[model samples]
Target: MTPTIRGFEHHRVPVDGDVSLHVAVGGSGSPIVLLHGFPQTHLMWRHVAADLAAGHTVICPDLRGYGASDKPAEAGPGTYSKRTMAADVVALARALGHERFALAGHDRGALVALRAALDHPAAVGHLACLDVLPTLDMWDVMHGVDAAVGFHLYLMAQPPGLPERMIAASADAFFGHFLDRWAADPAAIPADVRSAYLRACAAAVPSIVADYRASAGIDVEHDRADRTAGNRLRMPVTVVQQDWGAALGFDAASIWRAWAPDLRHTLTGHGHFMAEEAPAMIAEELRALLTR
Candidate 1:
């Protein structure tokens, strides 16, 4: 069953080559696209989207290989690159008559938002990232002991076949691990929502792993290239994350500042799933971003 998202109107919109994203659109006014992270679908934005919809046209979509969206076969490298996913979002917004829009993303989705803002500077009005770092910084911050905290990163970073097979063998338990640990309060994600996430992730193991695979490989290359080219998000960017850098022995703000000049760097105690755990707070942060 498709989990309902209150007042959202669902659509299967074409993005590119036989790929049509399952998008949930609501409200009116300036458009704001919301992208969900790993192990969850567009449903992750239920509260945030609904709240934002009161004053913005909220566009929520199950990213390329997630949720009810089309999961194309893992054809090759860069297939699930954030660049392609970002392009898919740009197209989705343009299709909805939004030449430019505010964008916010969490976890994996934040990576997409980062890439979108960097790649399509003019098309993104504001960019908000929740609980994540750029791909290169993510790898840099995970040295030695701290790497253990992101064991999934190493697992998915492995070359193809093994990661897919291993994750498949224990999909629920593996996916459920984050759904359990990443949230400050597990109850933030209702039981039904958790079940739906596990089910969707388990069923799309290949595509899901591919999404992570791209991150470990091509995404890092892209980030590196952007750094070499002195490219950064030219729009207003807000980053809200738990101060994991202090724990990981890395400088989060400095790293983010290098990429976002006009940046609102927030160090939140909220968990990784902040959008779900604290919708009102997330909505408020987004409002601040839009107003900037």
Candidate 2:
């Protein structure tokens, strides 16, 4: 049986003309949307969403091109760009009767949240990003031998055909590599959740690669433009990370501060999949962000 948040009800909410998102919504009061990261689905937020839902309406969605959501072809650079994904988030909220909401995201979703907060500041009351650097700073910090840790980013950034075919040939291995590597406690995922992640990722190889490809191309351009225009996240923002800057030899908080002036930067020892590894703590941080 597929695992789902206990009290949450699921729906396919239409954001674009034919693009609907697979969302699980529960609780009441002010709304809060949680976006999942790469190689995973909204299921990643099962624990945290349920906790936050106790005090706030929680909306957990399989990001377009991930999990059970619609995966449109990579029409162009705009197709899977974070900018487009961010717009989908805004539309989803408004469609569900939330003009503005607190937002939180992990990994790739963090990139989308960052874009959403920047592009639709009026629609996001507060923001929280987990375990990712801004696209522009990510490229800037990663160089030389240390950059090898992010081998998948470079692999997926290639032209459409090659990366897709390469990843598709050994889908499980490619997708499971991160699931196995990034967790501090492998049991945090258990057997069922791990299987779900591998299955979902195997089925969405092309769209997933297209998402990363856009980050390397058009996403960078968007972030660059924002930096040039001196645009910063206008709302209260909280960033929870693993201190990647120490490993990559850069100041992570300083980079985030440049993008989010009203920022609360924090460090976590719970590993990459922190939401799964430390749900209570992740929920606590998000709850605090909502109060800010």
Candidate 3:
């Protein structure tokens, strides 16, 4: 069986008429939604959510097309676009009785949270993004050699059928490669938790590919439009990232500052899966973000 946040209660909240999100809610007071990254479930936030729930209501939901959440077939670019996923998040919070809440996300989830802050500024009181750049800036900064690090992004960006087939053929090996490679300490993710992440990812291959494909297409367009309109995040924002700038040859802080004027960018020594590797530090960063 998969492990969950110790004190949280799970619910299937309807974010759309045909789509419902598998969400975990715990604690009391003001609400804060925690979104999980790629190849993982809401379980990634297990440690951080539990810590935050002591004082604030923590909502951890597996995003659309990941984990136990509803994975609708991709009918168009909008099907898995960050804009749509952001809407689902807003609906989830509203259904749970929060008209507005603080928000935080890691990796792919960070992209979604960024969109939510942009499109629904009034609904997100504060924002925290971990280990990712805005979609437009991401594509801009990735150059020849450094772009190889994001090979999967290019692979999944292909027209639907091929990327889905290649990944699904060796699902465990494909998904497990990330779980193994991205963590600074392999043991940071316990065996059970790791297995749960792989299982959730393998079972949702097509939808996951669709999610990434949308990033390459519709997501970029949205970000471009936002930039053209000078639409910046109005709320205070926090960004926690590894010092990837040193190796990737780009200034991470300057990139994020373009969209977020009230930003606090912290560089961490942890790997991509920092939440699992350094939960205490991540939780503290989030607590500090909430106060801003």
The 0-to-1 C-alpha lDDT of every candidate, in the order given, reads 0.91, 0.94, 0.94
How many clashing pairs in candidate 3? 0
Per-residue lDDT tens digits for candidate 3, residues 140-185, read 8888897788889999999989999999999999999888878899
List the candidates' TM-scores in order. 0.98, 0.99, 0.99
lDDT of 1 by residue, 72-164 (tens): 988987779999999999999999899999999999999999999999999998999998999999988888886798998888878879999
**Global Cα RMSD, each model:** 0.9, 0.7, 0.7
TM accuracy, model 2? 0.99
Model 1 vs. true fold: TM: 0.98
Q: Which parts of model 2 have CA positions greater than 4 angstroms off?
A: none
Write down the lDDT that model 1 would get.
0.91
